[model samples]
Target chain A: EKWASTAPRIASTRLALHHFDTSYSLRLGALWPSVRAGLLCEQKYGALLNNFAAADHVPQELEPLNAADFVSEASQKAQQWQRGAAVGAVARGCQEGSGEGRTVMQAEMMAQAEMMAQAEMSPPLGASISSKIKCYTFPRGDITRFRPARPDSLGLLDYYLMDAASLLPVLALNVQPGDFVLDLCAAPGGKTLALLQTGFCGHLAANDISISRTKRLYQILHSYVPREVRDTVSVTSYDGRDWDQVKGGTFHKGAGAGSVLLQVLVDVPCTTDRHSATEEDNNIFHKRRTKERQMLPMLQLQLLMAGILAAKPGAEVVYSTCSLSPLQNECVVERALDIAEAQFNISIHVEDLSHFRTLFQETFSFFSDCRLGELVLPHLTANFGPMYFCKLRRM
Target chain B: RALLPARALPAGPGPCPRRGCGEAAALRAAGFSQEQARRLLALQPRLGPEQREAAAAQLLLLGLSAEAALALLERSPALLRLPTERLRERAEELRRLGLDGGRLERAVRRSPQLLHVPRKRLRAAVRLLRERCLFTAEQLREVLGTCPAVLQEEPRTLHHQFQYAYFRMGVQQKEMVKARLFQTPFAELRNRHIFLERRGLYETPHKGQTQISNPKLKDILQLPEEDFLASLAYSTPEEYEVFKKLLAREEEEKEEEDVDALYT
Candidate 1:
């Protein structure tokens, strides 16, 4: 009904009905054109193409089929799509343009060899706390094929732009390398280009209260840095809960008197799953998941209380989001760790990113969700994302 | 914005609809923002308005800034359906590989799939690192500016990763381009250099003498196999997963004796 529950059986029934007129428009708010005219009705396109060719044998209560289970599952997927187009027109001889490009490159190499045999049937690394968090997945075949697909396009000796699961809350914000970090809603800036590719930040402010997404985060920190490592970066637009009164004074008065504001990230703004309120093109899937996801958890607990009041009393903020929504990730990091421990008396600490999974080795994959942090999800890991992050400390 | 759907836009933007004008006033007079030129012309609506003024005048004739070509097409929207004479022939083949002009616009703003790969797969990975990993063209331009996905690999898998780091870990092609060893994964650098050359903690350097103690291929491809088993294989992660399943059953019995010596 809601286009038989949010499409995604990895595209095909004619490109998932042309990604339901460009990525599921109006993501069902105002019953999206009566659910796109009951999914392009011609008597419900043979029970919505046999419920998306038995989207891996349905049942996540997507409910609705029964006219004898849609005429016996559309004649058993029209006899397995006529035995895969008669073994691809007898292995390409009846040349209907190289038999429909060898049946769409043999159904995209049998869906990438059944998603690499379901990522080699998961469940292995034991002694469980989610087997001490290992999900890596970048290029993962041919060794993260020289990584950099923009996280401010690598330079200062390719430090770390991110997505080996956003380098586990920048290795749980143990940032140090002249530490001063802050990101706080830093637009499209992949975690402030992974905290200025860690070339020992002695200062990095970055913000994004949208002056056109902080001019696309100062053209991703002047495209892969260097102008003296982008003159120790600053780029702002404020309103990260009035970033310590727009840096006028005393946010733990400059790195002294028991220093603070070392690392921050916050990374809020959510209801994401990268458009798919049916991307037929995109009206930003009902303006970012239904009318700007109803005040996204009070603006994600006011940017995790302006990244725990621009940290200092014992810095390290992290927070993060991409949103699969546990009320925008663990009820906004458990009400910003009970308002940074009872209305800023502070003394914080959360840690347990599976005790730094043997110091971030098997390229990090942590999902034991919300006792504070960790989650990567994308159908339980592969190309590591749908982030969530967590980690705090400021005792 | 009641989520528009009168047959959701196909031909709209042409006649000034309000707020900024044509091609959103030529992308807000070249520095975007009329909502980042209407969210990068609504994420490439087959880039009309004269292909977004010839892809922002071919990214200001490849010197960027028109807000860094609308922040590199808001971080590579498949480089605006490519073809600006194949983005000026992949920026003149990354300035004939010595990467000129701000290191070829920071390697095409950090990998715009290194300008849609294929130019004979970046000249067969720069002719397998200059004729079989002998490197030195300024050590393969500092290993293609510290790993530009080794110009999209496969010149016989970068000549079997430089013949397994120059003949089974005798290394040195400037220590395999300062141990970025074409960014690891010739089966996890032959299962961590044959599990530290079968635990005698490495050796192999001959002919130029110095035959025993070894380690640095950048600490065996950047450590963390549980800190290379608590600092150099004093071992355990269940004895390095039973020495990576006995070196993957001795590479499937040496690829079944080279397919039984190419069929006897």
Candidate 2:
């Protein structure tokens, strides 16, 4: 008596299994040559069994197959059957029955029974089974797996998922432990994460105006940070311009004194045309251009002023953005520097991002003074999204 | 230590005949030769007036090296002689200590035993040795002789070393904190919760509003409020159908409520 079941209709599962087989052979080839050497391995044997079963009748000559072939074929088929059966069992195993099968017509009673049986065996869990399978089945990727022990874990994840553009320059600036760091316009927290990663803070404070966005930022930090490091950071929801106003004095004079040396990262919002690939259902240029035009210059200027106001004497401020617009990049920086010249002695030292010089020249021709800061065009370094940055030191 | 040429010596008590002879000229004018004037300018004013005169007399008498005379002058506090060689030797000693000895000596004398230990090491040692019984060098040596290396390697010491290195490297506590926070099986579930919570939509019952009782409805619309609003703003016509249905249902309910109120 032969019993059999059809394969489940899960594209991800099929793909994962295929990937697993290929990777296993490639990896295990050196360790066990015999396993990789033979073409008719256990997997192939299972395929052979399925093919034989599909035939109407087995010929007399082929009916009694060799013992080795029969054993290999039987064992392989059983293994595949067991794994698929396990997943299906779990999906149907839920107390509430699985949803209707993908292809079952209203009149097809037989298909319904089959789907009912499968659902009964395998119950759907809210969490993706693929994630669990990835964690346990593959030992290689499991090395970095860790469980959150405290509330601050989410905070740490916000820091880790930061883009390379914001992270690299912070590393370049080389913040020391117990140094003061100010992040202006640090809402949904990419630069905030970068700053926290430095661990070089007597005090680190992040500010953003949007309450909803700040809440999201808090969630990110809560998810990502361990309890130990989470204690170091403080998030405040406030307008960047009003930071000094709220303090009732300059940050340098009030909060920062003595051993507190300032390092400020001003990552302001710009028209994010660069996220065109990731954002579906929108004309990237047309949708963002108007807002980019109106706000980039204004926000950039305000953020730069905030950074300067917050910085200690002889402190360095790194101003950055994700837009390629010269109006936002050079014009705002130049204007701010000009305004700051008389009141406070300031010097501007631009990072020579010679690596992406050609891309900047090609994409943004208006800003001839690449001397202000580094510009990373997405087309040049495919690894990073498009970004613009400049560094200013207070004299 | 080469002998001075006789002709280079001043015929009478006067400054060196060199053109840049401001201080050298003043010393020579005070009854010293050109060589003696140059030597006098370099010496400290610590020596006794008589000792300075005697040293000057000794320079004329013995013809010894300036270093030897300065060393002899340094040993005699009563000798009102400038210890130029002693000051030079002290400066060299400070350079070896990677400090300015003159400045350090002043600072040390002000607050003696001021050990300029490395900040990272000091922190590590403080954390390690905190609340432990004070052990002198003799006690530590005795302990080391008795205890095994394995026994010496305490968990506290290991923790302190790890923390110190991390602190010194400026490793952000945020990363560790985040690792503790989010990298878990439940983290993704929590993320979804946070997303929904931010939008003012939650799983629990509310007083006035109709609860989202259907599981499918809950899953499909589990986004934060801002995201939900944003989606509504730019939703496709097909997505708007559901909202339209809800709106129509609400209108019908209102009409039914009015009818029921009239009947009552």
Best by lDDT: 1
Residue A224 of model 2, lDDT score: 51
The TM-score values for the models, in the order shown, are: 0.22, 0.34
- Output the worst ten-in-a-row residue range by lDDT, candidate 2 chain B: B143-152
Give me the runs in candidate 1 sitting further than 4 Å from their true place: A1-136, A139-166, A171-191, A194-219, A222-310, A314-350, A355-392, B1-200, B205-264
Q: Give a tens-digit lDDT track for model 1, residues B1-264.
A: 575554555464533466326777787777666766766676666555766667767766777656666777777777787778887887688678877766666666766678788788898889778887778899888788777777977788888888878877777799788887877778888887766654435656767555456878888888878997778755556545645654576688789999999998
* DockQ of every candidate structure: 0.01, 0.00
Deviation of model 2 at B39, angstroms? 99
lDDT of model 2, residue B138: 40
TM-score of 2: 0.34
Give the per-residue lDDT digits (tens) of candidate 2, residues A1-395. 23223322333322322332344335333221111111111111010111101222222223343112222222233344345445555544662553566234324434334434433343331110111000001011011112222222222221132333444345334466677787777888755655664455666777788888889878766655456666766778778877767742655663545866778888787755334222333323333344554665887788788787777667778787765556677778888887677565555444443322321132221223464676553321112334677777776
Per-candidate fnat, comma-separated: 0.00, 0.00
- Going through the candidates in the order shown, the clash numbers are 12, 45
lDDT of 2 by residue, B172-204 (tens): 233323222111223233333322321223333
Cα distance off (Å), candidate 2, residue B143: 96
Chain A TM-score values, per prediction:
0.25, 0.53
